[model samples]
Target: MGETNDVTALVAEVEEQERELVLTRFTHDDAWQLGCLLVELAVERRLAVTVDVRKGPQQVFHAALEGTTPDNDSWVQRKVRVVERFGASSFLTGLRARAKGQDFNAQHQLPLQEFAAHGGAFPVRVAGVGIVGVVTVSGLPQAEDHALVVEALRIHAAGGA
Candidate 1:
């Protein structure tokens, strides 16, 4: 059910943000590397960073440790409903708040203790179209995790459509 419109919008957004060299981060090949790096940082700082990626409502991906989860960890079916209801705006706002320390969810894994502790997540959209997926990272301070995910998304989005 991936809408062509949403995918297109996401592609456009990726292109626009790709130029923000400061935002680009790790690639698919570096997912584990990024996780390790985040974990190291979390160990140093003593914080947790648990996160997830949602496509509309369905959580397409998630990275967490044992016994940790999100505040709104709804079932995939319900997640789809959430996506349709909230659109990308609400989803991104929630993810950003988690990264910014505004809406801390202690239920999720902590950075140092978790494989990858602290990180960030963002709505993946095609500029002219709409949201297609979500990118999230964890294993360091929320700020650092966010920076990495932003950069990685920009870098990864560049070659994708």
Candidate 2:
């Protein structure tokens, strides 16, 4: 079915993004760089956006571009919760739940007030270790949100500065 294929492709994309977007080491400096890149890309795209990078409970870098509201910040929090809980991209969590014919909320029982399975948050994975932090962007369409994060991470991984 079309929906099945779409889910499959989405899952593939999530996996590919995870595979390619890796950090040798994630530090406060790296978080700042990634967050600034997210803001720059959002500005270039004319998108009202908020970016958050966190290592556990410590906030590393956070920014809200022009046109973004407090709600965008809230979404960033929620989406990052998804990445924190799932150890995967928020988009992947949603797509995997859909593929299983279950709603993410129903399956996870995580409060909507604190968690979202929307796109734009990715686990900050370090090679040979695991997820160390999260990088999140909010205020775009779900797919576009996911794409923007992936692109920024790709650039960061490729030594863009």
Q: Which is the leading candidate under TM-score? A: 2
State model 2's lDDT. Answer: 0.88
TM-score, every prediction: 0.38, 0.95
Q: Once superposed on the true structure, which residue ranges of model 2 sit more than 4 Å away at CA?
A: none
lDDT of 1 by residue, 1-161 (tens): 34545545544453344334222333334344434444444445555545455544455445554343453232222323333444432234334334444542342322312222222444455555565554554444444655655654544545431
The Cα local distance difference test for each model comes to: 0.43, 0.88
Write candidate 2's Cα lDDT for 1-161 as tens digits.
89989898989878887888878988888888988998898888799888888876689999988888999989998998888878899999999999888889889888887888989898998999899999888988888988998888889888894
Best candidate according to lDDT: 2
